[model samples]
Target: MNSTHRKALINKLGKERYRTLINNDSFPSLPNDIKEAGLLKKQSNLDQVSHTSESKSRQISPTCAEIKSQQSSHLGAVDFASASTYEMNLESEVVQADVVHEQNPNYVSGNSLTFGDISVPISSCHPYQGFTKPDLRYPQGDDQEDSNITDAQEVFEHASLDGIAAIFKGLVCGAIRTTSPLADGLKPSKASVTTVFPPWGAVDCLLSLDICEASVEPLAAALFNATVKWAEKSLHIGFAGGASLTIPNSEVTLKGVRDEAIAQVFGSEIQQAIQQSRIRIQEMEKGKLTTDCVSMIITEKGAFISLSLGLVQGLEIQKKLYT
Candidate 1:
């Protein structure tokens, strides 16, 4: 049969049945043209399937691109929201910091202002007030008034030469009486001495003494004899006199006598001068006197006393008397 005819028959019988018929030799073998037509038909079907698949892929491309664009836009919106949140948090923190700054008194935000070690705020500062001067003068208080009243009741009198001579005589007798028994291996002696005073007073008397025994060391004996001679000369020189009672063989030394003897001898006169000065101050304070000066000059044959009343101004009565 012709190729066109066989192809038509093969299509009608189907390929498997046709091939079975040809193999049984019940039909003629298939021609190249028919086989080629079969191959061409299969190729056309594959091409159609490939074309449909390409159409499906082309149709899905726009939807995929739309989804990707939607996703990108959603992510951008989320990022913008997060950024806005961060900005809000930062603004809130800044606001809180401002509130905290406002609460503190010492917190200064602008130009730093300082005074010494202190941080000063310009807004809260005021004009500097000058320092107040202290009240350094003496207080005329109730205690001072009471003291003045008490002093007013007492008699104020200047030191007298006669009164001082009597005091000196009593003190000398007391000293000799107390020291005589203590001066062991020594004899009580008497020496007539003259001590010229400053223009204040003058005195002449027989000075008492306790002389060392003849068994004393030669050096001590010579010193005692020399001191006795020097005492006479010193007393004659007035202001330069160093007259003191000597009690040998006693525990007390000549150095102690030089340091304390003048003060001990004139202690009473010093106390009297101090009392008189206080009375004078009391009088001045009560407006009973015109002058605030108090001058006390106590003098004896062997000692001199001069007291300064300058320290009494501030109500401090200090002992500035020197012998």
Candidate 2:
């Protein structure tokens, strides 16, 4: 508590210790001493802080604006490079598409060119025109299809005749009977049957012809007329046509058989005559077929040939009675 004791205590402490205590601001009893110590320590701490902050600021000195401007420059160069590459790719694609379009407009397998108006493509070299395929059987008219039927019928008739004619002529009439105008129906000759083999007595005859008259009718008429003419020439018996010289329907009488013999023996000559006559008849009977109709009848007994003839166009039936 005295000044001497305080002086002794101050001497015991070293000068460095005293300075450390003052700098630390440990003794705050005297206001002036406390103020002076605090001021010295504050000044030293400020100098150290300023030195550290100056070093740190120098290390990270670039401003925010400067950093942003550098980034923008690099990004702009990258963008420009990418844009140039994209434009090149786009132009190449356009050129390739145009070339492909020019080379193959339709893109069809056979032909490259396309028909604008139509859906289907046409070949450059067409093998066929107008029609897809042609039919040779029926050429012209639609109704000509029926002509095939007629042709087939004729062929069948000829085949039938060929098969049976040989057997029929040799066998049916053993004695080989010829025409006898004076004889009546199927009179059996006292002739004995010697041959038992076929074709000696078996006979088949068929007649087929196309006429305005019914199918059987025309055949019968032609055969009848032929028989009558044969009898007149062979027997030297000239009788009136429809009178005594009568040939029944389909019945090969003794006289009628004679005519068929003449026809068969002299076939080529007879056929030629008939063909020539037919041509003349065709010319004469052109429009007459439709207007003045004539019918040829073929019957089981014999054939009939008849024609319609009227001297006066409009006359009563009784007016033309025989006087």
Candidate 3:
């Protein structure tokens, strides 16, 4: 504690160390060996931390790859399921269409079955063939005549009028014979009358008389004129009343006849009724009536009259009976 001993310690230690030692501070200057050892320990800890971080990052890379692979597999499964469902739906639709087509043969492709009015396909209708009455003799004459009569009877039994024109012709003939005066007066001359079938499919009745004073030609001619007048008065009341009597109802009745004929030909399996009415109203308005021709030929023979009638009126009423 002498001044000399204190001055000697201060000189050995240095002024800053002396001040720290005097203050009794905890932090003191370390030796070089101890400081170097502490620095080495800190550097070793830093290296270990860096190596652990790299190892964790390496482990996380594999886990991320596995997660991405699972996500891609899930997406592929979903896409396959969607495609299968779409294909199943498409197949179901095709099967339904095939079933519908098999159920209805009349349902033509690209055409739907409609209950409303539709156009009639005239081309599809049967072609017209005129009526032909069998030639038969009541009493058997020779063997040949008997054979001929048998053949005629067979033909008559099998004959069928399958066309609109033939049906209309038969209607007119039946109506005139049943209701007109022409039938009564012309019965006597029926034996001598020649029936001609024109190439144009028209029926012509030709009557020729002898030039005798007692000949019934005048009465026949008078009866013929009277028959025409009767037809005009009775049938043409609401129809066209000129040489051509075209009744609007004629086509309608003919259509009904067509239905019946179709039924008979195609059987009950097919629909007998036409779904649509194909009436040509424009033809009616244009005054294009059905044609009928009557011609008189005066020659060495007494008198000749040929009558051809087409589309007679009042046939609609008769159609109801047959239908």
Q: Which one wins on lDDT? A: 1
- Per-residue error for 295 in candidate 2, Å, reads 24
lDDT of 3 at 153: 34
Off by over 4 Å in 3: 1-190, 199-292, 310-323
Of the pair 2 and 3, which is ahead by TM-score?
3
Q: What is the lDDT of candidate 3?
A: 0.28
- Please tell me which model should have the higher TM-score, number 1 or number 3: 3
lDDT of 2 by residue, 1-323 (tens): 45555444444432222134323345324434445456556654675465346435434223433543444565432222112111011111111111223222221134322111122223432211122333457556746655654454311111122222332232121212122333764542221111111111111111222222122322323333332332332321123374444443233322221234324432333222322333223534663212111223333423332222221210121121111
Candidate 1 stretches greater than 4 Å from native: 1-106, 109-237, 240-257, 260-296, 299-323
Candidate 1 backbone collisions, by pair: none
Write one digit per residue (lDDT tens) for candidate 3, span 1-323: 55556445544443221022233345343344344445545655665565446435433233444444454566432222112111011111110122323222121222221111222232332111221333466865589675664464310011112222233332122211121235557522112223222222223211121122223233222323211112332322122233433332221111112233323332232211111111222333555332113233333223343333222221221232223
Ranking by lDDT: 1, 2, 3
Residue 302 lDDT, candidate 3, scale 0-100: 32
* TM per candidate: 0.15, 0.15, 0.17
Task: Candidate 2: list runs displaced more than 4 Å.
Answer: 1-113, 122-323
